[model samples]
Target chain A: PSETHRNAAEARQNTLTKPPGSLGALERIAIQLAALQETERPCADNVQIVLFAGDHGVTAQGISAFPSAVTVEMLRNFASGGAAISVLARKLDARLEVVDAGTLATSEVAGVVTDKPCHGTRDFATTPAMTPDETAFAFDTGRRAVARTVDRGAHLLIFGEMGIGNTTSAAAVAAALLGKAANDLVGAGTGLDSDGIRHKARVIDAALDLHGLKAPDVPAADVLMKVGGLEIAALAGAIVAAAQSRIPVLVDGFIVTAAALAATRLNPSCADWLIYSHRSSEQGHRLILEALDAEPLLDLKMRLGEGSGAAVALSVVRLACALHGEMATFAEAHVSESL
Target chain B: PSETHRNAAEARQNTLTKPPGSLGALERIAIQLAALQETERPCADNVQIVLFAGDHGVTAQGISAFPSAVTVEMLRNFASGGAAISVLARKLDARLEVVDAGTLATSEVAGVVTDKPCHGTRDFATTPAMTPDETAFAFDTGRRAVARTVDRGAHLLIFGEMGIGNTTSAAAVAAALLGKAANDLVGAGTGLDSDGIRHKARVIDAALDLHGLKAPDVPAADVLMKVGGLEIAALAGAIVAAAQSRIPVLVDGFIVTAAALAATRLNPSCADWLIYSHRSSEQGHRLILEALDAEPLLDLKMRLGEGSGAAVALSVVRLACALHGEMATFAEAHVSESL
Candidate 1:
């Protein structure tokens, strides 16, 4: 909250290429970055999109309408560049890499590069699921992914995940982050029926009871290690790494937001570089968005948590930056100035 | 419906360059045209966006938050290419033409063509504002404008309007078209308070009472003469001309929808080429959408009715058509088929 830096950013906003507030949320993003980098020209050039694939044991609980096979099938889809996110990444000219945070599949599929954190976690209903070491490794996996992105000159990063019952996991993470009830945080993920939703909420509440960590100050890393996925931990690492590198991170829908919440908990300054992509239709998304005081670009009632929303919104961000960098100011355009 | 024609369109849908349903609402548009034009390859190559600018006398009633001057100011904005629709038109490579159907200004404005049917109409709450001759002239203005677009090689059309307080006119038109109550059809036009909304409904009801056209059976042309603005008449005529030319038309938000309703009453076949762009957040938009049984491309809670939604959605349509016309099929990509 340095007023000097914030004022400089605000002044730069008057000079960015476009009309005042023409870029909408993107203008706000650049202004925030101006304050963070303490520079007039804040740039986010290298862009990386990380797809974390995982399989939830809750899929066995029949909480999702789609068969669990969709998880692996979609992983192949993401790898082969056929999923919506794949086309979107190509549209944005971003390098897309897939990591097996914990898919049920044993080995790497033909198109996908495999780095299995584990074959999948133990079912949360039965046990603590993953030990602290596994969780730290997951976070390190994300850090490694960031290292790869930084190596490739990706200055801007977007983290996305694909898992069938990941919404249940996302809701639990949101509950842990906000101290909200599981029922309030849970939603019909990927179009779940009422009964399935009820069961998913119950499962989350039961898992929380087993963990016995119900408060916000329970140490973010410890909470994540006990209940978060390898993909979520990796996403957190990527976020933290992006902050450390001074690269702005564009956060996608529910699952990515959950990852962001976990990351912000670890390093509070990480929030400064983050630009929320959309307000998702997922129930837990509002709580997570509110927790971050994040304003999203689009809200199309989309609950598809494959980072497609982020990908679409990324084009808007790029357009914002381009406008900020490209548009003529009032003086240049010779138009009457409102300010 | 002809079974052969329906089946032929279905077969065309199977062959479009993109996935069967990946284009979403654009797929419906393409298929509807495939059935209408009886072609396997549906093209919107020659696209034209016609903007009808007018001034509503009801502005004196204070139904809208934006002043009446915004009508002329935005007209200048459109002509000078500063508005959202202007940018969208440029992005889509679509030709933009503005028609001064009726404005408060009696004289011509620079860089804007005069398609004026009249200088302006009396406030609708007083009486049938425009005579049948004036309405005919307004409708003829649209028809002539469409001919000009066709002359310019436009095979696809978009209908947009720019008139402050037109939403009041639109709600009355919708109430008349659907036989609904005024309150049900009226909404906060250009952002209004509760009092403004109630006044709008009352004004619409009073206009309906003055005309003695309570039920829905009023002829489309009659409706135009009675309750519609000159721009509304122009829009209705544009739809007719697009239908006559067999060119597909993409309809903008609520006001344009009301225009389509007016056109459809004249000739039911006009609906064949009509594509609803997006449902506006305006209260009456959903009812109009449902009544038409039409699905829009995007839903971003936008109520800016200067065809901005339609223009934004056009990018998606162009993308869909481009993908449908350009991309290889699964058989060609050696990828598994099926969305």
Candidate 2:
């Protein structure tokens, strides 16, 4: 079946409306998925987005430019259809659902549903890593979220994170996954200056040392529980579940890539379902992309850490699918491909 | 009158199909033109792309990564619809017409028209620049091209250029226009590395020093006659034509920006019809943009010196116009704007 899906994708690509490689990397992805799902008309019709909100204890350490309250404000923004991601979802004609995995506030907000497993995690340098049980539950949170999406017939999903200082968390997770120096992966999150970047890197290095972070030889699920955010954990679960259910997942920027890395670590087959949308300008993004052996569709130096990149690339993908599924081939068009 | 156009642009932005600023910089351009034409239904229906092909005397200096033969090859590619710009023009459903104002080649090729006023100019460093008469003819060539497009009912225009070592020419033009050293404006065109960059800078400095180049104090036309390319002259003429005809002319990247600089220098009123497309990743693009006080629509780091960036942004403009023209307002949708 592994070989079967890939072969079908190849055949579908060959039969697509446009000339081979005319749409460049986009055509390649459409064909890759066609083979994976073994369908001629692979559609991202049931597109779903999961917004993972969490509080990073490192925010208290002043690693980010924005206050932690911005995360709550942004979560409300996502729910109220006022944020960039909301506009992007509308642009892609996709539905968005928000999940509050772990925020510092105890009471749940009315608009955004609280799937809060805990208020927030303790600072890694100042405490023991999150309990293994909390980690597992976080991963399950993502899986359950995908199950709900599946119930609504969502075949394509996007996992986006909204949290201040989460870039620090992402850097740590990326460092652990790729076995890179934490400082090299740390970048100016939300437009920090050189001094701020230096401070953020130091913070990540401190966390890595205290946590003794290492790339695991075990499953991605284990890795997520060990050093990942509740949001990252949930995304990992969602990725695995989507693959298991034959759904395609478009991985957004740094945070979401960290989640996908965790998922593939658990089940290598999950990589088959992942489509990288764009290369974030973040320092950690290139390394993550390299680890996944994935090439992004666009490189506009976009550092917006939402599912915005994925949502934008979705238009290109949908166009690719339409071109592949709808365009007349050279044989059909009676045009010579002499060049 | 200027205030009227400005206010009309603002009003049109409010009326366009999408939310304000949703189409970003593109909506700004369409609105500006709507105001200029004093019309609500601003259409890009008769879109004209005038491709100006010329041979830079600098090609003899071995400044480009591509051989001068590429100019001819690509002109053929444009004619045959095989180049990236060709594909993009087709994608945008634009009418592309080629003009061979000058080329090193002595005669016309089969598919391309021969409109050369000169085989090529004398090397600028070793000569008294293009004579006033030659520059005037080149400008006239551009005027005639725009007139033909206007006759064909082109309501909007795009000016494009093709020549090996054109970036070298463009950098010199940008430096002169922006009152900066030529070295500051030179960049690695078509993928030159650090070494190539150093050579380019040195070459520009040497050329400017050798020719005793100075920023033009007069209008852009006279400056163009002294220093601009036949293609650039033609483009400047086209921009003048667009202004006179009240057609919105989308200025492309650095080369087109240079042309705009020339047009505005000659006739300040020509600036009224201009729309700055994406800000190119070209080294001089930012400087050119700043000089024009132009707010470009997209900043995608694109340095593909064809009208590709402008072509892509046209989609955004079309979307804005469509949304402005088609989308249901809150009143029409019977939906209350969230308080």
Candidate 3:
């Protein structure tokens, strides 16, 4: 981030025709964007939404409420512009691309980029979710996806994911990073009842116990390979790559945030470029967000994935940029400043 | 609100390709808009922003952080497209009309609608803010403003206020209606120190005690006449008038919420037409929002009262409407629903 541009933007915000700090988070967002983009007048106008889709082998442990096939089917929905992210991408005027990281589908879906290293990861309840090579391959796919957006002059990026049983993967990843029990991090994902939640928690606990990465000395990368899904790793890769390119990333709900936690662990410098979008209805998201010391932009209690939360918050960010760049100064308006 | 439309919209939201209630407040917002618009597809496009600018007699008590001259100057700022609300209206593509509700200006500013019932209200510390007749006239001026918007085919209404020391008026009005002490509802207006806040609270308490409206069953109208500013009463009138005309109102921060509380007391039916846009950084805003049973859309801690909060939130509401009306349903997408 450019400190000079950030300081300049902060000064500009104070000069606008409103009370100091009255616009609250909006003012901070503009200054931060200016710093990240290295421009006095920052904007999120040309955002790129890259959605990573995969299938989680953990579904075999009855961890998810939905069937695994739904993951492959939703990719078709995204391609057809019938999915939430599809509609949001169109509405937000964002460039969206789908990446098939490790879904079970044999053939490629139309409009989805095929970079599958495997059909899916192994069930983490009994074994590591992905081999080291597959983990590296999925991460590179995400990095390449963001590089493509930079080629098109994208200003901001939002990473979305479509994977069944991914919430279990997210829970296990968070538990490992935070040094907590599975019960503390597990919550209903896509409508699980109390019994289902308990069962899911037990599955996560067993998986963590099975993997030696649960220890404090374990590298964050090992945790991702052992427990995280392909899309989650891809999201982590995208976040780091966006930071490297100086394009700000808006992190979505529980699943994407878990990837963000991993990204921050892998590359702590990337933390400055990540903007949290919302607190989801999922109970574990708050813990992950607090761990990152992030105060999210919105909290409409939304828990749907596919980057919907971040896509919705893009409007607020764009508005902040507009206000920062367009509003007249107090001197120009001939209005008195605060006494 | 039309219950039939609301129910149908609720059903439609559930049928979308997401888990039931996974969209959370966005879904509720869309459903509420449908009910308020009395249609299956609700859009907040064609919104009318009526910014009421006035000077408060309470400024005589030195209760504000800014000078009273700002009230009139901001009207010019609004007209010349220099103020916060001016930029917001242009960005949202909403119609903006400024009302000289009761500013101290001798003549009208160019392009501002003149409805000055008086030069300004009297200092309520020693006397009632307005005579009964002036209060009625200011309210009618607000009613007329909404009527004009209806003629132009507005689908939603946003009320913003510009008044120096109006926070004192708003705090006093809220204390009267909610039957609370002044300190419980007083905060920094623009940028007051702790000492200034204490001084403001003392003034409000003394004024409320002198007026005898700090008890339950005291008419809400009497509270407005005694302590409310011209812009506050006008906002209340506009809210009720908008409900009568069947256009939904997106209410701004503290000052406007106090007006909404008064409007609800005067006509409980108007509450259904109101959609809260945000919670403000002002300390007392939460109490008033709770009294109104309102859960606002965005809470960026914004306290700028030029309908700016509502204007910023307009993009979120518009996005919600678009997602609701345009997204393909589960049946249309051929995707499996949650088991």
Candidate 4:
């Protein structure tokens, strides 16, 4: 982000017809976009949603309400344009790309980029989800995916994930990073009842103990290799790459936010390029948001992942850009200003 | 709201590809729209934003950061498509109507409906802001405005207010109705510093004491006559009329919520027709939302109250309806459901 463009945008905002700072976060968003794009007229014209689909080995611990097969089923749904992200991507006129980081089902699906680090991941309850080399491979996969999108003239990047039991993986990563207990970080993924939530929490607790990562000092890559799903590690890499490339990344719900946390942990400066779309209804999302000091654009109590929250928020970001670019100044409108 | 249509919409939502209740408030909003429209295919195709512009005599109390003249200035801004709501209304293709219910500046302006009970209300510190007849007149003005929109085939009604120091009036009305202290409800209106907030709170406290109506049991009409601006009174009337006519009202930020509260107080069932657009950044809005049990669609820390929040949220509401009316069902898409 350029300070010159930010200062210029701030000046432009003050001259627009309304009380100074009356638009609130919309004004801030516009200014931030101006700084990121290094242009006075910042627009979110070219938006793309990259969905990283993988499967969590921790599903073997029975932490999720749905079976692991749902992950593969959803990837197929995404390819068929029947998933939530697909619906939203079409609504926003955004390009949708599904990257198969590593799903349990290894069959090639049309419209899905099949690139696997391994056949899913090892169950983190008894072993690391991925080896160090596999974690690096996934990171490079995500970076390459982002590079492809940016190379295709995509200015706004939205990251979503589809993986059964990935929320448990996210909870483990967050617990390790934030130094919080599993009970505090665990939530019912895909509609768990109270008993199910309790059982899920116990499973995460066991994973945390097994990994011996009940501390905040764990390195980002170490966290991913030990407990993160292949898709999450890829998402973190994409976030870092997007920031490096100066393209704004709109982050989605809880699982995606955990990836953002990992990216920020790896490259603390990457947080500047990330815009949190919405605070998910997921229990641990607020803690992650607070840890990042991220004030999301919306809070619709939406817990569905797959970058749906980010896709929904694309309208607001677009509107912020539209208003910033289209609204007339006080002088042009011939409106009186406060004395 | 038609129960049959609502039931049909709920049934349709249950059959969508996602999990039952996974869409959260979006699903509820769709069902509510279906009920209001009396059709399973709910649509926000024809939307209207009627901005009630007036001047508050309470500006004499130094309660707002900008002068009362800003009320009329903003009306011009709205007319010229320079206001936030104007840009948003244009973006959403919603009709924008500026109703000059009562402004201190009474000159006829292009694109403004110059209907005024008077130039402005009297200073509430020394006297009632409006007489019972004036309050009744304002209500009728609002009801008539809404009637015009509904007659023009507007399916969604969004009410916004443009009045300097209107927040002070709203806070007083909310404080009186909610039985809360002035300090608790008052916030920095239009960039008021801390000292300005304290002064505004003191003014509201004095106004409450002068009216001899500190009790929450005071009549809704009496509260309006005591502290409400002409636009606020008109907004309450508009809400009542919209509800009676079965048109869904997308309630805006703080001042608009206060009007909705007043309408509900007048006719408790009117709350059923209201859809909260966003939780305002204002201090009193949360209390009002709680009192009404309103779950707003968005929370973007927006404090601009020109139907901007409602216009921004119009996209979300439209998307909700679109998803409900357009998304393929589980059977139609051949997607599997959870066990």
**Off by more than 4 A, model 3:** none
In the order shown, the candidates' DockQ scores are 0.12, 0.07, 0.83, 0.53
lDDT of 1 by residue, A315-335 (tens): 555544443444344444333
Local accuracy by lDDT, each model:
0.73, 0.70, 0.91, 0.88
lDDT (tens digit, per residue) of candidate 2 on A1-339? 256756766665654322343344645766766765567556666688888888777776778776776666566667666566676676556888888887765676667768867877667657643677788777787788888887787757888877777788878878877778887788877657788888888877776666667635534444455456777777777789989988888889888888888788788988978988878778888988999999886554556666766766665566456545554444444333322
Q: Using TM-score as the measure, what is the rank order of every candidate, best first?
A: 3, 4, 1, 2
True contacts kept of each: 0.01, 0.00, 0.82, 0.53
Clashing pairs in 4: none
Q: Candidate 4 on A174-214: residue-level lDDT in tens?
A: 98999998888877678888898888888888877888787
Candidate 4 positional error at B250, Å = 0.6
- Per-model TM-score, in order, reads 0.77, 0.62, 0.99, 0.94
User: TM-score: which candidate is best?
Assistant: 3
Q: Provide the DockQ value for model 3.
A: 0.83
- Using lDDT as the measure, name the better of candidate 3 and candidate 4: 3
Considering the true interface contacts (CA pairs under 8 Å between chains A and B), give the fraction that model 1 also has. Answer: 0.01
Candidate ranking under DockQ, highest first, comes to 3, 4, 1, 2
Better of 1 and 4 by TM-score: 4
| Model 2 TM-score, 2 decimals | 0.62
Candidate 3 colliding pairs: none
Q: What is the lDDT of residue B156 in candidate 4?
A: 92
Count of clashing residue pairs in every prediction: 4, 14, 0, 0
Q: Per-residue CA lDDT of candidate 2, range B127-237, in tens?
A: 534778878888888888877777787767888887767788778766766668876787767656677878877777776666556644534554455456777777777
